[model samples]
Target: MRLALGVQYDGRPFRGWQSQREGGTVQDELERALSTFAQMPLKTVVAGRTDTGVHGLGQVVHLDTELERTEFSWVRGTNAFLPQAIAVQWARPMPEPFHARFSAFERTYFYVLHVSPVRSAMLAGQAGWVHTPLELDAMRQAAACLIGTHDFSAFRSSQCQAKTPLKHVHQIDIRQHGNFIHFRFRANAFLHHMVRNLMGCLIAVGRGRYPVEWLAEVLESRERRLAAPTFMPDGLYLAQVRYPEIFPVPAATLTSVPWSAVWSDPASSS
Candidate 1:
């Protein structure tokens, strides 16, 4: 039988999601735990592979196993052997046709930034920091120019392996909460470092380093060199992945941070 598992992890300690021969990745740790629980080697395929320093709030994975275990057992047993920073939140028996990656119809991400002049040691690895005061309206204007299908070559990393730069961006929401700013992005797919790259440009516009119109110009140029440098990964989070209705997976829970309440209020500043 195939099993799908919801996973959450803090990526500060690992070398990204994919397993490496050196074995310090989130995938390696989870596989080790699953193998230990199953009493046999087990492998998993993930919905998305995050880069180093990027966090996962609701990562999904699928694994095929012959051993039969109750849903609760799968979660408890696997988590028992997993590290403190990595966990199997939930598990369900899935049909053979269900695939974590291919079945995903949309993905959402959040980038949280500390906009204060003084940085907080507590949020060092959890959020990005910018000492300059950002103009929220200007950032919103810049983000609006990117809300559609476009060849995003200027926003993707040179190492990106995607066959095409074209991608559909459903939304780009800019919200402010006191000293922090949140960037919410929803899309069909993302290229390597795409969000970080875009964030770099948005920050430039926010700081008045570039005019809002410069964003559309960069998009039309299709030249990576024309865009700002890729931003830090500490603020990036894979917040959710949406699949078809046929699969009855639970929706990802949002973080209970004080700023999260703003997400549900349509009247809140954006």
Candidate 2:
């Protein structure tokens, strides 16, 4: 049977999402755990691959398994064997053709930055701390310029393996509250390190290092080096994965809220 899984992981301990020859990785740990729990070889496909040190709250994956175990127990059993940094939140039997990566409709991410003279001890590892203050309104304007479909070659990582530089960015929201600044974005898909690169460009505009018009200029140029430097992965979060249709919930559970509501914050939309 095919099983879909919702997973959360702290990317600090692993090399990246994909399996590696030397270092640990989320995929390596997950495959090992699934193999032990199912007593059979289980291969899994993820919706996205987060770079090392990134985090995920709503990452999705699909696994092929021969055992017929309760979906709820599969999650619990997997978590029992996995390390503390990775947990399987839920699992459900899926149709044979269901694929976590190819079937995904949209992927959302959040990049957090704490702007202050000094980094906050509370968010030291979770947020990127920039000592200089940034202009929140300017950042919002810069992000607004990135909305809609475009060839994001300028903003994509140089090492991106995707065949095309084209992508549809549904939205890019910039928001600030006290010292916290957030860049939340939604898209049909993302290239390697795409969100972090956008965050860097937005910060440049906010700090007056780059003019607001520079964003559009870079987008039009389609030159990878024209964009700002990539921001650290500490602040990036795999916020959610949107499927084509409502997925089955575990037995006796109430219907889930819409995917939009799961991470919606009007305050961040501006």
Per lDDT, the best of the predicted structures is 1
Q: Please report, in order, the local distance difference test score of every candidate based on alpha carbons.
A: 0.90, 0.81
Residue by residue across 139-242, what tens digits does model 2's lDDT show?
88877767888888888887899988888888877666567776779999998988988888888998999888888898899887888899889878887787
What is the per-residue lDDT of model 1 for residues 1-270, given as tens digits with 9 covering 90 to 100?
Answer: 999999999899999999999999999999999999999999999888899999888899999999999999999999999889887888989888999998998888889999887899999889999999999999899888898899999999989988899999999988888888999999988999999999999999999999999999999999999999999999899988888989877777665344567576764222
Q: How far is candidate 2 from the true structure (C-alpha RMSD, Å)?
A: 3.8
The residue pairs that clash in candidate 1, if any, are: none
